[model samples]
Target: MAYQQQQHYQTQQPMPTMGMQVGGGNRNAAGKPLDSNGKREWSHGLCGCFEECGTCCYACWCPCIVHGKNKQRINHLAAKGSPDPDGGACCSGSCWGHCLLTSFLGAGWILQCINRGETRGRYGIEGGGCGDCCTSLCCHSCDLVQVSREIELEEKSFGQRY
Candidate 1:
């Protein structure tokens, strides 16, 4: 039965595939997962122990998505001023402070939805609001804020089409 228990434990304890879990088995009532260590590293909706840490920040990965090339350049730039970028007295244990770029591309989903003169949270929110729903579903039911229907279009080059 020891072998069976070990195998069961292995399957029950999934590891991080994209980001870190921060803490152990402190799952929510809905079993949404927890960050017992409170490292706040955010996950890719995976429920695993704190040990299987993920490098990418699922919640605040703006820098990764927007500045993909810049990130590679930063990493490729042969070592830096310090043995580790975030090691000074002013620095925390993590290099998050050293990233010289913004993370998420969107300011806020709610703001974008409002600015677009729309309702419903169709676009996924990055931080406070906004997300990736193509339909204008996020703005209609909102009562706290209202946006006018008139909107101006900004023209851009071919590269900005996407």
Candidate 2:
């Protein structure tokens, strides 16, 4: 009886196929599958800023909040997991100094902008309809909403790529 049960279990196991999607999973959610050039494109264009009304409005009115949230989400996705998810030094332990810099130097946006570049790198998304620094500096609200949308829409199936 033991030998028979062992054989039954062994035969019941599912076989792993090469490149076969196991369960209606999408490996190409980030736009088209990798081309011969080996790059994946963003599912949505940067100019599609108004695609998400809530994100656009939030980014417009509360730029800092939008940037902070985008930074956190990007960090989480890029690192698989990150302790400093907010990308804020205060939250990561250096409270007073970071607070001072934010208040006086006004450099908090730099971290968020860096994360935007990181997100572009991860998905091979192109930059420079206006360029990263200019987009982050001049049209920050639009850039924030666009980045948030890209991550939200495209990252749904990203983990399975591994």
Per-residue C-alpha lDDT of model 1 across residues 1-162, encoded as one tens digit per residue = 455544444346666532332222111112223245332212222222122222223213432221222222222221331111221122222223223322343323433233232211111112223332221133221211111100000001111221
Provide the lDDT at 161 for model 1. Answer: 23
Off by over 4 Å in 1: 1-52, 59-83, 87-162
TM-score, cand. 1: 0.14
The lDDT per prediction is 0.23, 0.57
Task: Please give each candidate's TM-score.
Answer: 0.14, 0.58
* Number of the top-ranking candidate, with TM-score as the measure: 2
Residue 148: error of model 2 in Å? 0.7
- Give per-residue lDDT, candidate 2, residue 25: 33
Candidate 2 versus the native: TM-score? 0.58
